[model samples]
Target: MSTVPPLLDGPQADVQVLQALRTTWSDPPGWLGSLRAIDHKTIARRFIVATFVFFLLGGILALAMRLQLARPGLRLVSPEFYNQLFTMHGTTMMFLFAVPVMQAVAMYLVPLMIGARSVAFPRMNAFAFWVFVMGGAFLYAGFALGSGPNTGWFSYVPLASSDYAPGKGVDIWAQMITFTELSALLVAIVLITTIFKMRAPGMTLGRMPLFVWATLVTQFMVLFAMPSVMLGSTALILDRLVGTHFYNPARGGDVLLWQHLFWFFGHPEVYLIFIPPLGFISTIISTFARRPVFGYRAMVLSLVATAFLAFGLWVHHMFATNLPEVGKAFFTAASLAIAVPSAVQIFCWIATLWTGRLVFRTPLYFVLAFFVILVAGGMTGLMLASVSLDLQVHDTYFVVAHLHYVLLGGAVFPLFGAIYYWFPKFTGRMLDETLGRWHFWLFFIGFNVAFFPMHLLGLHGMPRRVWSYSAGLGWDGMNMLATVGALAIAASVMVFLVNLAMALLSGRRAPGDPWGAGTLEWSAACPPPPHNFDTLPVIHGREPRWMQQALPSHVAGLAADAREVLVTSALAARPESRPLFPKPSVWPFLGALATTMLFIGSVYTPWAVVWGALPVTVALIGWFWPGRRETEQALALEQSP
Candidate 1:
């Protein structure tokens, strides 16, 4: 099992095997097939598209808030409506859009990069997507019905408690967290399994792509960081719905406990959003600079160190709260210390760019933007790490500016670059270079104009989360300027949409390896086939394309008559066995429906948890029920290949 099996030959036999694979691996025909499809690419494409739609929706919410704040005392929206607007904007961007989009891209790219046909737990992967859809839909449905959560995205209690904020809105927010976080945990499991046990032969832990390494690191962060929020949200919901005293101060519960749990996940949440983008930056930099990333081992170590240090910095967010001076000092030290690893990564990327020939494609334009914006953001982050600076700027537009600079610059810009870099691989065409440059410049300039003034406004004593302000408070000009810049951002997004549409329609067709890339993903056909590869590739060196200048360079002995993916050891990546992956089913969709009922119903009465379990149990049973064909196939492949 440690080596590849013999290749199939003979024209007639090869034809039959190939045909059987087409039959076995292809989705069932028509719309039904589309619904039941469990292919990683199918799920990832749908997941990615769904997240982008959420991103646009979140942006709309942001623009509305901007319009309301465009001038002092605008009164365009009531304070109540403004609350929901800002609340949903933050919640949607953080929960519905950013984190999931990164995973969605990883879901698509990881399998191809590792030369696996599909992610591990394909059924669970499908389940995760449906669950995510339900969660997002539920949140928006609440908003549409005028029951949107008015509590901030952080939803701090006392303000969020049942006594003060009594409604179904907070309940919806809490339950939505359950759905999204559950989906995230499932995805983390699927990705971790795929990376460790399903990598192509000879791709040991060392030889794995930097993106894959980043993904592996990010998922581990998810495993540790996600549960705290899940627990905290569940407690918040219980306090609201079930008469629990988790956050009720009068009931002997500590309000700060909520903060403890939330920020524990919250600060790491920043890294959760950014680490994958680091991967995107590394990939784009190496590909465009025409060399392997400088200090590859250092880059990998830096990523790991970043995740490790992210947990320690969460306490810094609570510096202004009633905490010990010693604790604040420790977090400040930890916060400043994290810059070491981050700076290491920056210097390594600089070394790679400086010594190598550069290709300034649209993707690189976005990547280069990351340095300017994120570095500036990082400087401000360091400033805020000081308790005095945080106390001065806390709860003000300065904090808002710092967050946007970090998240937008760190994640969003890199993500756009990734789309340009990989769009040809996703679709069979390239994005228009002219429109791309326009999109980048307008977006970059607009982002700064809209946000940078917020820092000065904060310094001038303007608080965030305000519905309206006095007319002559020295804020009108900056407010108008920010509004104009936001409009520019909206326009840039429109240009991007046009570019996407035109590129999909009649842009130049792409080759298998458009960038002359060195990774395994480039070895597949453009917009690769459903099975990914005609032959499951074996790895030789880190850059498989360069090491073995051939498409899909691996021996073939897998079962063509059934769905099979190679499994390997975690460290050396020695071949272990070929396991049969599950096929498409409607059960996951049904299961999500049943689970949604349980979650939403629990919002009304605690009894929902008691009775709702029945249908959920039934759906789980249906989901796991084995087919006769599957049993036979399993028995056939239980031996050596």
Candidate 2:
């Protein structure tokens, strides 16, 4: 039988081991080591920053479009340019910013929250972030070259093909879909493995943190949903470049085929953007309200139920496409059925606030805003669920208003709360409360003023994506009102930026548990050490920090010399084994760079796809190559810590 050495035997041994771990796990000195770093924190920060940059770019596009539409006949931009602007704006926001940002937040927080030292596959995590960054850059490059896709965010066929849409623009958009889908798929698998295998001992499936549970469910959704778009976009690129007629009606292809594939992926994409925010709301409410989340099991079931029902309602998006009436009725019912889970979540939040002491901080304020806005969005969703109503307002600004409400209210508002709630944990500094309040009110009022008018304009027969309209159409006043609101929204974002910048530079230091929170993440040092815990924590109950129970004994057999973490059973999170970690390497980044060449080059010729695989294969081989000898040497030569 094998016996492992004690990682912590006595007080002195604990100090020696912790000091050694700090030296071993911390980022190596100098720029070269920084470049080679594979730490999850480093990569998560990169993902967040990169996704924010895309958000800024996409927001600029929105403002430009809003400006042109501020008046009845403004010619600030031509129709073609405006088309490109909206398409790029929608595509960037949904694909490049919203979904990726949520995943980035998960990447940064999941390990810390779950009491894991690092993500399951740190190198793979880094690789996914880099791929997503490169893909966003490539798509924007097409915009810079005056070749951004004009077909739409969904890129409906024939209009997206070379015959109607010549040039490398649509091809660029299609290939970027493949890049992002691959990135999403990779991150989902790694995160799922991490959550299942790396939770602290005694953090059973039921005991898993709510955000971790939300992330687990979302990743599962990603695993099942991403392939449809990946396959669709691949076929689109192939048809455009090589004359394979996957979407061509002349070649016996159905026009509706693109709709089927895209919506199948697209509908779930909304929930993928949404489900985590539900977790964020639950966490923030529970934290500030001084209570455990009400209806924890019901919330988990609602998340899972929402994910399942999300797939069934994709057909509702095609209500105006002339599908059978029976099919339309089924989709309509499914779409409306989704409202039940959402209402359950919101009412649970209200119920929590009803019974507990409430702290109305910036985060909680945003959560409150989410409740009001999500309900408004959901009501419109119910309206649109009817086949007849969708036909009337299918392509109008009403649809636009509904989506923004759902997304901004449902996801972005909660995300703001999440950022506020976790800012201290990540940055080791508290954001200014006064400034946070200003940011919240400005954003909240501005968001309503901007979108609420769009509903009126949509009802008044204002179609979406049009550069300008006739002054006689009643849309002029509402459009002008929206423009004013848009400016307010932009100003609010500026306020947030200023507040964030000030806090990072000069904010007050935060305690490990600034809000007296209950989760494991708050148990670590503010901006936690490289080796998260000096000795791994033993979790006893759900609210580890709040229970006031005697702390459980730390695990003793882990090696202090090498990077070692315990792997646990999936359900009970019982200790199963220890796994050695891979050293920092540049291969993941190199592989992503090589893979990017394939995506970008394919826009020129299909031959690039075959050629691109060679470098990628080489990079993968090197990435997975073992360092068994060096690892053993490091472990054997180590003194007793």
Candidate 3:
């Protein structure tokens, strides 16, 4: 049966349709226009590139720390500087790189996969990106000024308070948190709305892609999880700036309050950095394995369950803080129980590979390595979930090893896989396979070599965040080995960069469906058009392209003379509105600038809070004001009387 019936009768009609779409959906031309762009693709590309730049910068910090720790008593950096390096490294990896990069991937891929023209809140998407960029810039500016926060990424209070921290560095860190969390929260809201409201016609709840489902759950996590940190940071800022004494235990404030609030956000922050990569794993596995995911309903259920359970595990990070016994037991049980969903996902992927025809591309190599590395990390996590065991190694290298295992293994491994898998789709060219394999192996081996001995160091009682250790304590040899491994990992990253340069410059061209994938995105052109679709596809089932059938219908009647797209009912994707989008504007960027000033100004003086509101209010008013076109139409109607 014909999947899509001809909407236009002939060539002339098709040309007219194309011309109308091009005219209506076109972004403004020139560099200035590009700056004011609201196109999801442009914003997403900026996000992805900015994310990697931060990653590279963070990696350099990691290498610096490794060099300092490579041999005990090697004073590459002083203890104070070491503290700043580690704090910024952790902060950049978690806030500046991981979560934003995952969101960037979704920003680019989600609309294409779901057959939507653009994200639901296009202006907000651009604003989120700008806010993130400015926030990172603000944080790094403190570093450049030699005033980086020295406490930790968690920035536990009393230590991070004005009395002891005694600098603008901690203030900068606190405001950075506020900026980033707000940005993340806004992006999450937009993504959740888009998933629920902007799916193509007939792409019902059950028919949505697994990656989309994973993204939905992750954004919900971000929505629920981000506010706690923002609140905590705001309170911390108030304490630092105005002497509110929220963390001032001597004045009746409880130190444990910061722990509770921070961890409440912190533990889920791990999954915030981890879950979307799980989505990448499922998508890549399904495509390369040449089969439907082994357990679609189960995978969706597991993702939802994982997100819910993630909230309950936050208290586990506070195991050594001397909580009530029952509370500890409850949190430990919750932490351990959370692993069942992860195990289910792991087993399902393994079963899929066992039953299907597995293609071992560079992407799959990383996924395969993820299975080994992440499972190993999960095992260590189970160990740490024990209150007794956690007390023995809570602040030691063991915890460090476990974290990298979960993050690098679970998140970054799949991230690279997704990058290779989707690179062709985005750039219309193939990455060099030989270089890709080299990148994967060197990174994999170097990652293990660098992190594995930390397990032994922890077992031997090596505490974390120490600038130097005594050479006689049986740590020097392993530390040296780790340094070598860190260097290897750095080399691997350099190779990957070279390969990306080669691909962009002169790699073989990619076809639309380079991987013979089974998703709506593959049905579009490689480096798809500005309008996303020449004609909007009507989805019939999951894996529409897999079935090799035309879309069951096309979303017609959406005006091609203006920026109009279908707005659907939340559950069934029944069209509800034909909304017109505003043309790209510079206001979001300008508003973000205003907001950055508010955050930065508040760091030095509390009065900035009162004064900062004026510019912010003005910018927002200008941002949402009706366009000249809309005002003209309203004026014409009024004058007709």
Candidate 4:
């Protein structure tokens, strides 16, 4: 059996082991690594591409809806088909795109920013990505097979029950929710563990970057919020397939219970999606503004405070459903109260930009736009928080406009900026400036043009989800204008695609620290190595790159020839232990395949669950039944801890 290698030490030894380090940490030669590699960078890249591909698919569905709605009396699609388009578009973007994309980006950047060799559970991270892909595939496959969900992404009950909705479609929708939410939960656990136990020595909670703090809070939100929806979906599947009464009102299950469970997750879901971008905005503002962000402690407290209050306000979505006055009052208070933390964060970013030496890159332009867009969205949100006003425009185009403004403006714009800022470090190429500016202007203008008119249409009594409308309703003009803007948004995406293509193929090669940022990620080589850093950094401040002169260059004595990371105390970040991480294996992929079968098979027949469990059990055995070598290494590591 193989034995643990001696741990390497000393600054000179760190230099000497660079080549050995790369070799030791490199993926196995050929398909063994190519197909089953557990390296965070490789897995993160794949996760990112996969999520964006889903984003593109979601965008196509939206464009089709826009086309059908472009002019009154357009029969480009039937009402039935329109239902499919609307439902799948929201599902693809929410479950498949927005949430996953943020996790994907974080999965790539988190480890490097925290100065860890890999995520806390690299194997679990791979498994999470696979499960996410399979879940998305399961969803789209049903759509292709004419069994796609048409009951809306929310899939409210009575309508979603087997009585009203008889088909494989709702069954597929219920199952897919369980699938994607499981993937989300696993990833959240991976990120939380990494942030808590794997930070570099001397990087205390106070010294952590705002991005890292944001990631931590978001994951915690996921852990708490996701299970509510998962439980709701599971109960839904049981109700549909087994005749349970979890959501059936006549037999004692309340229809409003579904709303409660769903919105509990739903409202927090918006913040979880929105919060990460707050971190992205802060990082970009600090980088382009050339200063540490203003009010570090306040920013951290604001993030935590926002998370706590998000749960209390979910009942506001149920205001028109005849909730008690006291309950409505409490929820309304909650919805407005959450805005305080958000405004504080906004002010901090503005102050950072106002006082510092500013650089106006594509990322900064996007950040600047974020302020205007989110503030507008927030005002509408306050309006919606009022029970009296919301009763007027409930389920109208105004709600649609408000949502996109919050999601697209609050999340997507910043994501684009993040891409521009981090692209060089990721791909070792600078995205062309002129093309980026063109892409931004088109996207910004297109977004406003497409969404702004919807607010007026809503006020004019344009209820959403209508396949077509009469031409004389005074809505045609705005509808046409919105369609034109949709095309512009499409064109902007095309420009971004072109820019990305040109940069990857033949753009200017970037140097390490091309932006001269203070974060630890820029301290590494451009595009970073498979092993990340050759030596583990000893952090002395929030921006390790800026404090490099005062710090000890490297932390020594971790094993160089094994997949290992320092286990630090959660609060103080003092070194506690270095444990050997598992190597690349195909079992994660195999395990995902097994789980997918169980989920899909359960949709058609109940016995499939029992049959499916067999292979799933086998896959689990192959995955966690460690060999003699791993057992020996674990024993050795534990001996001295």
- What's every prediction's RMSD, in angstroms? 2.2, 2.2, 3.2, 2.2
TM-score of candidate 1 versus the correct structure, residues matched by position = 0.97
Candidate 2's error at 32, in angstroms? 2.8
What local distance difference test score does each model get?
0.91, 0.87, 0.89, 0.89
Model 3, residue 86: distance off in Å is: 0.8
Model 2 C-alpha lDDT per residue in residues 1-641, reported as the tens digit of each score:
11123434677766777787777677666787766777888888888889888888888899999999999889999999999999999999999988889988999888888888889888898889889989998999889988889998989987888889998889999989988989999999989999999998989988888898899999999999999999999889888888788988888887799999999999999999999998888888889999998898898899999999999989988988868999999999999999998888878888999998998899999999998999999999999999999999989999999999999999989998999999998889898899889889888998998999999888888888788898888888888889888888888888888988998999999987888788888878889888787677788888887776666646656666667788999999999977677778888889999999988888897888899999999999999887777666555634334
Q: Write the per-residue lDDT of candidate 3 for residues 35-101, one digit (tens) a residue.
A: 6898888888899999999999999999999999998789889999999999999999999999999
Query: For model 4, what is the alpha-carbon lDDT of residue 56?
Result: 92
Candidate that scores best on lDDT:
1
**Model 4, residue 193: what's the lDDT?**
97
lDDT for predicted candidate 4 compared with the true structure: 0.89
Regions of model 1 farther than 4 Å from truth: 1-16, 548-552, 639-641
Please state the error at residue 485 of candidate 3 in Å. Answer: 1.1
**TM-score between candidate 2 and the true structure:** 0.97
lDDT of 2: 0.87
TM-score, candidate number 3: 0.96
Candidate 4 TM-score versus the reference: 0.97
Error of 2 at 322 (Å): 2.0
Q: Candidate 4 on 421-467: residue-level lDDT in tens? A: 99987898999999999999999999999999999999999999889
